[model samples]
Target: MAFTIPEGLHPDLNPLAWMVGTWRGKGRGEYPTIPTFEFAQEVTFNHDGRPFLNYFSRSWIIDAEGEIIRPGASEVGFWRVKEKNVLEVVISHNTGISEGWVGQFDGPKIQLVMDQGYSAPSAKIVTAGVRLYGLVAGELFYAYDMAAEGQELQAHIWSTLERQVD
Candidate 1:
């Protein structure tokens, strides 16, 4: 399939053009404090002739047969590209946690590390995190490693999502 850059997209975001679309897929997740589980996720990245990409993602726990079991995490954020492939991101999650991340992108791969974070009085604290995004065989591959609730940074979730066609 041919990929065309979105109309009116800012020049600075050209490197991220490939990510500007909706992607959906299923994945598995596990943490030291929780049992392994399956999940379905949808993520979207959009631009409005701006230097940044607006991002939104939602996930739900799924049974072995891929049936939705319950709602999971939802987050909204923005991705900005700086000089030399540097990326700056800010995300706010439905669980009352917000974070700032810094990283760099090389071609179709991006890696980000948590630079700062905040948690509400009733929310769990995430002391650190790392995220990876890449294009693999025409699919969006996503992975997240995080340290929270006194656990060390480790693989939490990963998924491969096909781009949704209009």
Candidate 2:
């Protein structure tokens, strides 16, 4: 499955155009502090003739039979291309967490280092994080590593998502 590059996109946003679509897939979640669980996730990326890509994601905790037991997590964000190879991302989550990430991009992949992080009083704290996301044969391949709850940086989540036609 090859992702199509969106036409008439903002000149500065071309490199990230491959992400301009909806994607859905399944992923696993695990942490030393909590039990492992499986989740069904959907992520959408869209642009409005601007330099930034709008982002949204929603996930659900699922049983072994793939029945949604409850809503899991969700976030909204923007991916901004500042320079040819420089990008910035700001994400706000319904889970009471927000993050700012800076990274470099080479059309297909983006590697980010958390430059700023925030959490609301009612939320859990994530000290820092690293993310690497890219298009692998048209699939959205992404992963996260983070430090939280005194657990040193470790794999937090990873998923391979296929483009959604609608």
Candidate 3:
């Protein structure tokens, strides 16, 4: 399907206009500190005539049959695109971890490396991370690798989501 640039989107965000909609899909997650799991997720990227995109994502643990078993992770953030496709992101998780990421986008693909992070007294500290997002076969493919608790960065979660038509 052809994509139309979202009306009123700031010129600076045109490169990311393809992501300005809600997407839904399932993903798998695993970490050295926890067992592998499956989750259903909904992610949205929207803007209000601004230079940045507002991002939100929520997930729920799912059973083998794809039924939601319970709530999973959620995060809120903003994505900003600068000159030369340079990208900056700031995200805060429900678990009290907040991070700053810097990267660049080439066409439909984006690669971000964590620059720093902050954790609350009760939250786990993630020392480093890498996130990859791309448009593949008309779907959004997302993946993340993270280092935390003295462990080296490795695969953590990944998902494929179809854009929702509204």
List ranges where model 1 is wrong by over 4 Å.
Answer: none
Best-first order by TM-score: 3, 1, 2
Higher-ranked by TM-score: 2 or 3:
3
lDDT of 3: 0.97
| Decoy 1 TM-score against native | 0.99
Write candidate 1's Cα lDDT for 1-166 as tens digits: 8888899999999999999999999998999988999999999999889799999999999999999999999999999999999999999999999999999999999999999999999999999999999999999999999999999999999999999999
TM-score of each: 0.99, 0.93, 0.99
**Total clashing pairs in model 3:** 0
- What C-alpha lDDT values do all the predictions have? 0.97, 0.88, 0.97
> In candidate 3, what are the lDDT values of residues 73-111, reduced to their tens digit?
999999999998899999999999999999999999999
C-alpha RMSD values across all candidates = 0.6, 1.5, 0.5
For model 2 the local lDDT of residue 11 reads 83
lDDT of 3 at 141: 99
Supply the global lDDT for candidate 2: 0.88
Measured by C-alpha RMSD in angstroms, how accurate is candidate 2?
A: 1.5
Segments of candidate 2 deviating more than 4 angstroms: 1-4
